[model samples]
Target: MSIQILNLNPCYDHWVIISKPPKTPNVLRGDYVVKLVDGKGLNIARVFNTLGFKDYICINILGGDVGKIIHAKCKEDGINTLEFWIEDESRINTAVVYEYEKRMLMVNEPGPVMQRKEVENFLEFFSSVLKENGTLVVSGSAPRGFGIKDMARIARFAKEKSCRLMIDISGEWLKELLNFEPEMVKVNADELRIALDLQQMNLGELLHIKDSYNIKVLCVTYGKDGSVTLLDNRAIRVKPRVIQSDYSVGSGDSFFAGYLYYEALNKSIQERLIFATACGTANTLKYGAAIFDLQDLESQLSNVDIMEEEL
Candidate 1:
């Protein structure tokens, strides 16, 4: 079977723009634009689709009319979607743009809370689809009231099915789920700092996560500084390739997709990290969450510098 990735959480959105920041007793004065879809997992799915990979998305879709619109957009993109319908409408995250000051502010909704039965149904659906010898990616945040135990259950199920699981999450959810022993975990520097409960840990200190968990890989993305991957007591640091960036949103997801694509092809870990960095840098050249072409990625892969060190 082809590598199968399952996205448990997804969102539909309306990205709006405002001329200025709202003050006390704020009133609307600017344009209110609505975008059809937005979510971390969906973004990853988009990138994968562009990369010509066969993948599936599993999401609990809510709301009435808007939910249909979201599903329509996904179908238009040729993305395979498996949805669980619910009572409330999907969320709309607003991005307020202050054109004069050249600043942008985003306000996100908490989304609808999932009932106990809804959660159980989602788990059962996921367990049935999961297959051994395939890879599963569980990304993004869970709805409120969903705890780490839920994550642990999914991770454990994937493990028993002999599927490689990769997670990208932050805060208490990430802290609690680390005990489940995923195949790989990715987080930004700030999240890493908070999870370890330290202001800063040197390279040596950062490598300790591998010793503590049976995790095969731990990747830390450092924005313009590029990223570092720890595997089997060796750390490889990849420097950012010079590229003009229009937006940084979804760059990490693109990187993860790139790494996993190469990994599923059985590439070495070093090669995987190099391709991952190239994918991330290539994303900087495009607007929104657009994916980089494989031909372009292959051309740029040689330019990426990977420095390896042993801890």
Candidate 2:
């Protein structure tokens, strides 16, 4: 079975590095500038392409001229894309990288609000292209018109087709998707706590709820501290080699892509978790989102340590 990515909410992302904005009417000079598609699934797909993994397809919602730009970029990367057109233009998200502050300021727009017809059209398109027994990746925030219940419907549809559903989302939508029992879930520590409505908890506490749903794996990323994964009733903590990085916007996507890569190769579970963490750590060294240098990844991979933990 092939790999398929469903990222309904996509945006044209623009990144710029500058000192500061001028108060007077003057042109602000940027040290560097980049414009590209921004969506978690697309980020993961880029890693797939980088690793020369073919037979993968990405589907996203698009509209207006911005949509065309995303499509063109995907084509340039040699990624097969399925675009669903809507009436409203897709949103533009901008990130200003402050050289001195060493942090990025993000300004995001609410994506296109789907009409009833557009939603129906998307469902039709998803059903027509979805592959059976394939890996179904659903990621990113939703568009303005989509809600948790609507997302739950998609999860149910994937389950009906016997697809391995993997979701990387947050908030109430994450709560709703949990009901369908996805095969895999990757969330940040904050997102995991928020989803389970806990002040402080461990894998055991979360597993109390997930056990009933039969989720195969639950991964929680704790940024620099590393990540923990629960699988086969074993919880393991993965530590990565720390490296100086320009930005961390796409680390999670790279991690997920690495997990999928090893999964397709039928590697041991321990190898998958460690490789995923290394990919995430390697992504921080670059400016472009989801970009990973194989040399860096391989170097980091050797340092990735997996420690079995008491759950």
Candidate 3:
């Protein structure tokens, strides 16, 4: 089975570096700049490629100069992509990170609006690539013109194709798609709370919601605190080795990619969680989003702790 990633709102990310954290009404000079092709799906594909797993496809919409650059960068990185061209210009996102502090300030654009024909053409192409029992990952945000209906159509297509639907999105989009009974989903704790409109969130509550939606696997990450996963009627908790760096822009995406990578290898749930947490922790050691050394990932594997808890 193949892995397919769909990212509708891909962009060129420009990162600026500073010596220290920024204060309100203070002037700051950027020490340097780093640019990359960034989007949730692209980041997942990058992780897969870095792990030397080339059995996946990255799908996105490209337009204008920014889109051209992103396309070229994907080729340079040797990432396979199924591209759809549009009329609107792609987005450019900016982030300011500090050298002394581990935090970053990000400004993201909404991305290009898709035309009617563009959306229809994409659905046609999407249907052609889907295979039985393959994994279809839908990540990132939808373009302005694509709404819940458009997203539901994608979900329905996946269901008809007999694919395992995996997602890493939040807000209204997530709330609506749960009805389709995705096979797997990964979301931060805060995103889960907001998506469910719950006043309190805990492991038990997570299982309750997971069952209500009939989801097979549900993973909730708590950043540095750790993560909890519900799989095969078991609640597994994982604690990662403490790393002193932040630079956590794409850490969640990296975690998701790690889990999917292990799943592709037919690893057990416990092993998957350990590798996922390790991938997330390893991402903190790098300045670029979702970039981690293979040796670093291997070293981190021993630093993760996993246990099953009664729910």
Candidate 4:
């Protein structure tokens, strides 16, 4: 079976912006440009497609005009989407800003609530797809009424089927699921602080979680400070590659995608982390959640510095 990504929650969007920061009233004197597309899972699927990986996106689709637009966009990207349609319209998230300020203010809609049937259907679909040993990535936030335990449930199912699960999430949701012991957990610095309840813990204390869980890999992304990966009884730190920032959105997802791609090939954890960071840096060179080009990724990989630190 091909690697399957079960994106339990996803979105559609219309992005509008100004090239420079607005001085007063935070209003730009230009046309409100609108671009519509699938959100998180779609972005990850697109990157996987660009990297020539076998993948599928499982999402819940609500029926409406916006849903039609989302479906159309997913088709354009060649993403094989298995959607569970419902009564409500899909949500629309917006990001508004001036490019020069290097800051974006976003307006997000609380997604539609899933009925019991919707959730059950998604679980059935996800389980059927994982009959064989393969990689399963469950990322992003759950909708209303769904808690971190939901993620743990999926992880549990994957575990029962002998599928490797990689999770990218934060807060209590992540904390609860850690008990399930995913194969890999990716957490950014801010999330790490909350997960370990370490407002004052040093790097050593922060790195100790690896010993406490059945997790094979623990990745802590430090934004511009680079990223640290703990694996095979060692912590490997890689400096972030410098690049002009077009937009930081989706960089983490891209990094995870890149990491998992090379990982599927059985590369060393150090090599995987380097490629992952390189992919994230490459993502900043483009606007929106654009796919990272392979050549650019390869070039950035050369500049990535990886060092093993004593725990």
Candidate 5:
């Protein structure tokens, strides 16, 4: 299957490993440092590549020196990218992972702003590259000068081109994309609540919303609690295998990648959830985002449990 991952805003991600959080007036030292081109779409692409799927391409808008660095790093990592270059500098984000703790502190920069013409040019480029019966996975937030209407237009055009749509985004962007009726929707529990403006999430409400949107597969990830999914007219609750780790930066993206990989192979939903949950949990086994050993992923598979859930 033809597959493409979309990330509207790309960035240079820097990671530092330290013993603990810094205190005021302290001279701290990092134990290790790693840097890469990262975004939700890129993370998904990385995981897919790790899983031996290398035919997909990552699509994003990048700019300035930081964008140049991002492009170079992605090339080093062997990630195929279709970039829309802009004058505004791309973003740089940092994450501090702790050695003693299972948590990380992250600071992210808002991405560059695009002019009206740039947006139009990007849409035209996206339209030119779209393939019939391809799969388009839209992930991450949009940059400045991009709005929900612009995002919806992409979805509309993808449908017009007979592409299967899957999304991993939230807030107003997600709320708007629902009208386009994507085939698969993945979001965390909090994002789902916020996007739909729900006070609480339950099976009945999930069913109502999914039916209303005609969404075929709705997956709500609950972090360490696993995920609750509505698929094939059934509710499935997945309980992930807990491993020894505190870092979970790109687990969601890994999960999305895993699901798409298995789906492309025509795996059953039961099989897909097991692999997806395993992949997500596997990402926490390391400090870097979406970096996991195939052995680790395999080890996690048998431990993941799937059960039929009821309201």
Candidate 6:
């Protein structure tokens, strides 16, 4: 199956592993650390690779020295990447994790602005690559100077191309996409709350949105409580077999990627959702984001409980 991924806002994710905290306020060196090209797009790509799916094509906007590193890393991973170069330096996002302390602190940078020519270039490339029966995943946040109209245009183009679209974004970026009715939407509870302007994720409202927009599937994730996937007439909940996690990042992306894997196989909704939950739980067992071996995932497959939830 062909899946095209767009990471409009990419970043060099610098991870600082906290080993020993200083007794007093003083400088303490990290035990071990690493940097990875991240943001939802890249994370999904990583999971896809872990699962041995190599057909995904990623289109990302990169710039500056960090962008160079991102490109080199993607190449090293053997992923098919198309880089759109910009003038501004790409952003650096840091994640400090104190696993023993069960504490994690993340500092994120706003991404660079995309020029008019850059937007046109991306559109041209996207149009050239999109084909019938393919999946287009527009993920991550819009960069600085990116407007809602630009996002709407991309969704419209995907719709016109007759490619199935999956949305994993929030707020105004998502508000604009709703007009075009993507085939599937993956939003966490917080994202759903913000996108729908509600204090809670009301299942009825989610169903209404699906019916009103002609969306086929809407998935909302709740951190430890599992997730609910809503269809036109029914809703299903997929619960993880194991809840313990060390790495705090990439579970959502792993779930989405896993779901995409099953979707590509034309699996039933229940199998897709169950396998997605299994992937997320297996990912948590690994230290890094979206990192899981087949052994870990296969072991967890028996634990995921899929049940029908009343909408």
Best prediction by lDDT: 5
Cα lDDT of all candidates, in order?
0.71, 0.83, 0.87, 0.73, 0.89, 0.83
**For model 6, how does the per-residue alpha-carbon lDDT over 193-266 read when each residue is reduced to its tens digit?**
87778754578777877888888899989876789999866899888756777564788888999999888889
**lDDT tens per residue, model 1, 190-283:** 8878876865556766667766877789898987788888888688999765755545666888888788777767889888888888887777
Which portions of model 5 miss their true places by more than 4 Å?
20-24, 309-311
Clashing pairs in 3: none
- TM-score each candidate: 0.85, 0.94, 0.94, 0.89, 0.96, 0.94
User: How many residue pairs clash in model 3?
Assistant: 0
Q: For candidate 2, what's the RMSD?
A: 2.0
For model 3, how does the per-residue alpha-carbon lDDT over 201-257 read when each residue is reduced to its tens digit?
Answer: 876688888999999999888998888889766899898866658678899999999
Put down candidate 2 lDDT per residue, 109-166, tens digits, no spaces: 8878898878877887788888888889998887888767778878877988899999
Each prediction's RMSD to truth: 3.5, 2.0, 2.1, 2.6, 1.6, 1.7
The better-scoring model by TM-score among 4 and 6 is 6
**Worst lDDT 10-window in candidate 3:** 19-28
RMSD of 1: 3.5
lDDT of 4 by residue, 69-177 (tens): 7778878877777766666667788877566677777788887777777667766766676655777777777666555555667888888888887788878878877
Runs off by more than 4 Å, candidate 1:
14-36, 55-63, 96-103, 290-303
Best-fitting candidate, scored by TM-score: 5
Cα deviation in Å at residue 195, candidate 6?
Answer: 1.4
Q: Tell me the number of clashing residue pairs for each predicted model.
A: 2, 0, 0, 0, 0, 0
